[model samples]
Target chain A: MAVIGVALVRLRDLFGVVMLSGLFTLTAASLYVVMDAVDVAFTEAAVGAGIATVLMLETLALTTGREKVTRRRSLAPFLMVVVTGAVLIYGTLDMPRYGDPGAPIHQHVAPRYIEESGREVGVPNIVTSVLASYRGYDTLGEVTVIFTATAGVLALIGRSRRTRRRKGSQTTGGDQDAR
Target chain B: MRGNIILRVASKLLIPCILLFALYVQFHGDFGPGGGFQAGVIFGSAFILYALIVNIESARRAVPAVVSRVALALGLLLYAGVGVAGMFLGGRYLNYSVLAEVPTTGQHLGITLIELGVGITVAAAMITVFYVFAGEER
Candidate 1:
């Protein structure tokens, strides 16, 4: 499945690439849902399927359809992947079973959020209370990140109209001289 | 594109429901697994759908670029203002218990205001992102 996904991403067609990316996001969201992380799944669906796919399609619109050939060797990426995979495997050796009742995560600060957050925050959604209230500074930083990205997008793609206007004025000058 | 009946009809029916659901999720998040982030995404998705079905220019006309920028800034200000309010009431930064004279329940009121701020910022940001991306096609 991974190989097929990679192949789809490598396909020359821009639409195909966007579709493949959506598929990859859906698969990741499914995994999250299966792991009982419904909130994470919801976010992955929204950001991955909804926003990222649209952004990629928009990017393709601003560029040539053809994929450029890379001359760089693959050894660095390959070694990095291997090392990361090894570390992930090593870390998983001592991990608790999926949905285990005794998992440390369930026994810790998480439970406090689940149990007492409603009374303290008057919000039923513990995730929101935690994200916006308990850790509001982090959420503020996240909003800043989004704000920066919005500015960057505007800077990059928002210049086309000015260039077009300049060309239009130049053509008008030529027409005036001809008359 | 303006004459596409299918897209126009579908979006008309879907957009309202999406916005309503976004609001429901925003307020009902305490019991469920949703909050500002999820609600913002849903709200943005509705606008994105509108942009997709209708013309991008028309969508822009409906939601001007300047309005989105203001919405983004306003959300951040609302959030910071709540925290500052808390500080003035003699608590630490963002310490919700100081927001009210009542000792026990002030934290709850502060949290609600903060969540509102998050929801606003997130929704505006998401819509702005969609607008920037959708605008590229033209």
Candidate 2:
């Protein structure tokens, strides 16, 4: 992962950067798998590595392939990154140790979900029970957020006149023939 | 493209497999460590793959923005509707136990429905975002 990060920084070619970022995501997914978070691993793999890479490649198709190197360097960004990392590390100092059974999180409602989900939710998968039943409101909110994002994207760039014209000229059942 | 017959043929073979896996992930989520979010991204990537091979315009025609738009809202509605139904059944918001006569069965029905809703919304949102971003020049 560090190697990929170094390669990403050293390579000015935007395509290489995108590819490396995908590699980075895959690494993160692997790390999640090692931590036994299969669902999260799946999400990171599918979203971070798969769809994001394709979207970036599509963006690359419309833009320059290589990055423009700046002659001047800014220390502000580097300092900001260092400060942020330090603060995050500091914040983690108070976090419970990994997988401690006595941790507050484990002592909370998680135990009830784990113990009673089979009888209550009748779902063999505790994770699903928690996500869809115990915390259905959060899932609803997440769906709504996705809907809003789609709406925003549609409003912003869903229609492109050049695409419409080219599409109209191409085939009988093209875009313009309908709208 | 080099009229890349290999890319075309391989994609044709792979697209079906990808879509099948996406469906598998969606339906099989309750039993294992899969769900709507991951399945939806995979589903969206299938279309993105098609767009990569052909063009965004053709992909758009195949999917159509209107379908995505409707799906986006419909999924959210289904989720919230389940909660509303719970209320109508004299339970608290999102109390799936009231969804059916049998509490366990109601849970199964509620979770399945809501998961399906999540799957639909996530897939639609992802596909729509890809279309907008990869559509054309500003």
Candidate 3:
């Protein structure tokens, strides 16, 4: 994954970058499976490795595949990234170890959910019960957010009757649709 | 792409399986590690594969823009309606215990319905976003 990240940063070809990123996501999904998080792995595999790659490729088709060369060498952004990484790493120092049984989360409401969810929800998969039932409001919020995002995309680029009239004319591009 | 017999035949074989697996994920989420979100993406990708292999116009014809647009709203309405239904059933918003004679049964029914709603919305959203992006041209 680290090697892929380096390659992604170095590769000027957007197509190769997209492919490598897909590979990286696939690797992450496999790792999630190894960690016994099959639900997350399924999502990463479907969304990250599958649809995201297709979407990026479609975006590439609309734009240029080769990234433009920039001669400017400003180190401020790089320094900022390094500083932010350091701060994030420092933040993780206080976090519990991976899968720690005595972690705060394990001692919190999770215990009640695990112990009582079967009786309360009668679902074999605790994750589903929690997501669809216990966290119903959160899921609703998430759906609303997705709906809003799709609406924004529709408003911006969705084909309208006015735009339909100008179909097959590549020179007009997307700007004419704003009118 | 038009003349690639291998691509054409292979996709025809795989698309149905992809769609079937998506439905399995959607309905089998309770006993498995899949759910509406994953199922929805997988479902959308099947049509997306069809679009990528064939053409956008044919894909649009297969799933018209108006249909998807309505589905996008309908799914959300279904979810929200479920919540409102709970309120009307002498329970709090999104409370499923009162949805049926048996509390667990109600929970089960509510979960299934809400998951279905989520799956529909997500699938429509994915398809709509793709249609919009793929509609663009240089």
Candidate 4:
């Protein structure tokens, strides 16, 4: 996957890069599905595969098609990555199995969400009940984050035609013919 | 543009079915494995298909940029509004039992509203994000 990602970066074709990114997202979503995180997998498949890929392609339309190769080989980042990988692997030695039935996660508040949530919130999908009711505030904050990101993207993209219209008719008059 | 006609026609038919299925998943989530988040993504995927099959501009016209923005805000407002309503009913924030005079089923009603809010917000936000990127110059 990493090799594919690097190859995608090196490739000049923007459409190919987008397709590669979709592949990476699919792989990640598959991993999430294997871990029983169905919701997370669904999100990765939708947002990563569907939206992000489309966005990247749109951005490609406005930019140079070819990637410029640099001669300089930066070894510092590679060294850092190796060290980080070693540390991460060492840290994972003490972690439990992927689907350990006796895991602490299954024993704690999870049971409440699974057992009591149906009676309390009256929702069969425990995840929804937890997300919308038990931890609703967090989801609200998430929505705000999305809103902020959208606003940021729009601002960065600059004012649409409406903004120029408000400024004056001078710019719009010239662009009207082009459209 | 050179793709199979069958694929195009099938996608055209499948998109609306996907959306209807998403709605079913959202509403029937209280009795199944699916819920607001999953339903939202499914719903968004349906629109994304339409955008792909028809054209981005046509999809934008169908869903409209301003309508999507309003839908996004309204979703959050719906969720928060229910919580505020709970406060007015003399309970804690999001306390659903106080929503109705009949306390037993009030929780059910509250959960439904909250789920609906989540579904709306998620679906709109997902679609809006897609639109933003789809229209981007890069």
User: What fraction of correct interface contacts does each candidate retain?
Assistant: 0.63, 0.88, 0.90, 0.55
TM-score of each: 0.84, 0.90, 0.95, 0.84
| Location of the lowest summed lDDT over 10 successive residues in candidate 3 chain A | A170-179
lDDT of 4 by residue, B1-138 (tens): 326688689998898899999999788877665667667778977887788777788888899878887888887788889989999989988877898876637777887787788788778877877776666542
Candidate 2: chain B TM-score equals 0.93
Model 1 stretches with alpha carbons more than 4 Å out = A1-4, A69-74, A99-108, A159-179, B101-105, B136-138
lDDT of candidate 2 over A117-176, digit per residue (tens): 989988887888898899988888888888887788777667655666887878698664
lDDT (10s digit) by residue, model 3, range A1-179: 99998899999999999999999999999999999999999999999999999999989999889999898999999999999999999999999999999999899889999999999999999999999999999999998998999999998778664566666354466456433
Which residue pairs clash within candidate 2? Answer: none
Candidate 1 residue lDDT tens string, A1-179:
49658778569877887878888888889999998888899889888988788777777876766677777877998899899999999999999997787999889888888878767776666676788677878977877776677777667654344464666577866433322
- Cα lDDT of model 3 by residue, B1-138, tens digit: 888889999999999999999999999999999988998899999999999898889999999878888999998999999999999999999988889999999999999999889999999999999988887766
| Predicted structure with the largest lDDT when compared to the true one | 3
Name the docking class for model 1.
Answer: medium
For residues B1-138, could you state the per-residue lDDT of candidate 2 as single tens digits?
A: 538889989999999999999999888888898888878888888988888787777888999877987888888888899899999999999999998999999999988888888888898888888877776652
Q: Which DockQ-derived CAPRI band holds candidate 4?
A: medium
The TM-score, computed over Cα atoms with residue i paired to residue i, of candidate 1 is 0.84
Candidate 4's C-alpha runs over 4 A off are: A1-12, A165-179, B1-8, B101-104, B134-138
Best by TM-score: 3
lDDT of 4 at B72: 81
